[model samples]
Target: MKSLTSIIPAPPGWYARWRFGTHRTVTYPITTWALARDTGSEHTIVVGVDTNGMWPGGDDERPGGEFLRYIYEPIEAGTPDDVFNPVKSPADLASVG
Candidate 1:
């Protein structure tokens, strides 16, 4: 049997997708989890996958087409409480379309 992590690297949760033009689409499990800090700001790291689903030839032929995508968004600055708290589980992640 395959490990759960291998099947679903992230816990099931509300996800978000960002599209860049007609060629790229990025989808990730959304959360308020912060991974680092920069001076007065708390930065949240989110890992996602990019897919060129509409590409005529498909993504397999594109160089490093299946590469992982990492994003960092600033959550807050200066105050500890202002920093967004981590979403502990998929159930806790906010619902979205």
Candidate 2:
């Protein structure tokens, strides 16, 4: 079985996409539990997750068990760019509109 660290890859283009989407700049918390704080730039937003070891399954078994909490965060637009950077600036919005 793959370790959680090995299974979860670092987010690709997270900084650039997040910066562009929210229009400001954003920073991730040093630890995973902290709520992401928005930098309040024109179009920036912060995103985060909690790693509280809430998974189910016995200590001797793999994590894929009945009691596991399957938390699914929806990525809208069904595309990586759309899901990551769904919004553009006001000027760009005008053109798209």
Candidate 3:
């Protein structure tokens, strides 16, 4: 088992990975909205096991089993705001043209 703790918050688009004994590893990336909400806070983190290039061992090596230990920290409670505006429809574009 492994544990990670951080006092500084991760920034949007930031990513990190951990490798265990050159065989397994995990990675995480920060969310965009969290960065916007708290420029100084590090809230989001993820943990996963890396099975890259490993051969499947039939029933013992199911896809679900590969990522069973992966964990992603959730964002704080809040209504998620849309980050992008709605695009114009084909009709709207034709009218503009």
Computed on alpha carbons, the lDDT of every model, listed in order, comes to 0.32, 0.27, 0.31
TM-scores of the models, in the order given: 0.21, 0.18, 0.21
Best by lDDT: 1
Taking the tens digit of each residue's C-alpha lDDT, what string does model 3 give over 1-97? Answer: 2123332344443333333333444343423212111234554343321223111122233333232232343444322221111364656433421
> What tens-digit string does per-residue lDDT give for candidate 1 at 1-97?
1111111233334333444344544444443322322334454333332222222122332443343333444434222221223544545432221
Candidate achieving higher lDDT, 1 or 2 = 1
Query: Ten-residue segment with the worst summed lDDT in candidate 2?
Result: 25-34
| Model 3 residue 67 distance off true place after TM-score fit, in angstroms | 20
Model 3 per-residue lDDT at 32: 25
- Candidate 2 is scored at a TM of 0.18
Task: Kindly list the per-residue Cα lDDT of model 2 for residues 1-97, writing each as its tens digit.
Answer: 1112212332422221122232432222112222222344333223223222322221433232223122232344233322323345757543431
Q: Residue 36's C-alpha lDDT in candidate 3?
A: 16
lDDT value for model 2: 0.27
Query: Per-residue error at 96 for model 3, in Å?
Result: 52
Candidate 1 residue runs with Cα over 4 Å from true position: 1-11, 33-97
RMSD of each: 15.4, 17.5, 17.4
